[model samples]
Target: MRIFLFSILLLLAGCSQTLHINERYSASGQNSRVQYIVLHYTSADLNRSLQLLTETEVSSHYLIGDRTPTIYRLVDENRRAWHAGDSQWQGRTWLNGTTIGIELVNQGFYDTPTGRYWQPFAPAQIEALIGLLKDIMQRHQLPPGSILAHSDIAPQRKVDPGPLFPWKQLADAGLVPWPDADAVARQQALFSASLPTVQWFQAQLMRQGYAVPLHGELDQATRNVLAAFQMKYRPARYDGEPDAQTA
Candidate 1:
């Protein structure tokens, strides 16, 4: 009886060890604590973009192709991808730690010799993005404003998902906060009046969750933040100057 009991104990211990090993492997291979969903443009074709994201050091959680409204999950939602680098938003830096990045295939911001520019994103691609974003937002309980662009967070160094991105369409779909046009028009009187000091503009940008130094000077960082805001809101001109309309 004693010999039989010893053998049974050894077998139970081995099973427990195996179970612990399996659990460890599973946890190490997957992602966790996914919070924000960030949008980006690959600036490359679909095949090349996928190859680069999967094989190269750069990767995203999801990739949307042109002409098709399907999303390719490159990295699992639980694992961290190396997409966002040197980013900041709402006074917080290093967005990769808290965001899931989505890369859309496109060649953004091509300039012509005649000073005209071209930026094209297919309708199917936008549709795919909407669906994917809806799923991610629901799963993670992310707020509508948390759905951000790479350029929105890192304006100085990145411009993916550029001005051509139809942010208004997303807003119309109840995916994000569209600035109240009436409020903007009413504020236009204040903006068009006396040229507000750089301090005032900096405060506004800070209140809007953009990273800017409160030095009261219109520095490059301030210009970048203003340009990002105008790209999303004004859209007509994003020259970074606090003109009568943007002041």
Candidate 2:
């Protein structure tokens, strides 16, 4: 009877998960919890950024200011930050769990009577960002080019970290990949003569880690995805249309 009662107590303790785990054994197949780092623009100044991120349900792991380029850690890295909303990448959805989000203080864009104007990231801010990214990537042991723009994860609904976000800077810093200019020029000449089909474009974007459709139609959704890609690669023009440059 005493043995059975003791067994019952042990079973209850196991069920409760109340015992301290042993640290002697380690698994070789486990990866870091952080697989990607997402960049975003707060679309507000420092004061408003704090208010918005703190007052609302929206939050990020880090927030960088523009003027002095101050770095703020609003959310701990061990915890999930509510930054990537309705986002997906590499077939993984709801990236708040496996990603770290960093928000930059910028107004994003403004639509005037002439056209839309995007805000450029400050130089000091970019420098600070590079340092911060290095620290995070070092700590997490993340691979190069694991950084993603918010639009890359959710092209349909979000466009922050827009055209002026300077992806090439990240690429130059060895944080992201940049296309070969010569290769792009040659491809441009060929595409300018004869643009590829919608199916081909869809396949290429999908190859570039975009969740574009393969239905062989130029739908609005597909255009949005293309626009997101263009915004990062070719910032001069991103009308979401399949043209020679886009091709």
- Name the candidate that leads on TM-score: 2
Model 1, 1-247: lDDT tens digits are 9999999999999888844344443444544366567888887788899899999899999888886756889888777899999988887788887889999888776768887564678998898788888888888877788888787888888766777889999999889988787887787887777778899898988887777778999889889888887877777787788775675
- Name the TM-score of candidate 1: 0.85
Q: Give the TM-score of candidate 2.
A: 0.90
- Weakest ten-residue segment in model 1 by summed lDDT: 18-27
lDDT of 2 by residue, 63-108 (tens): 9999989999999999999999998888889999999999999999
> Each candidate: how many clashes?
2, 0
| Per-candidate local distance difference test | 0.82, 0.93
- Model 2: number of backbone collisions: 0
- Flag clash pairs in model 2: none
For residue 168, model 2's alpha carbon misses the true position, in angstroms, by 0.7
lDDT of predicted model 2? 0.93
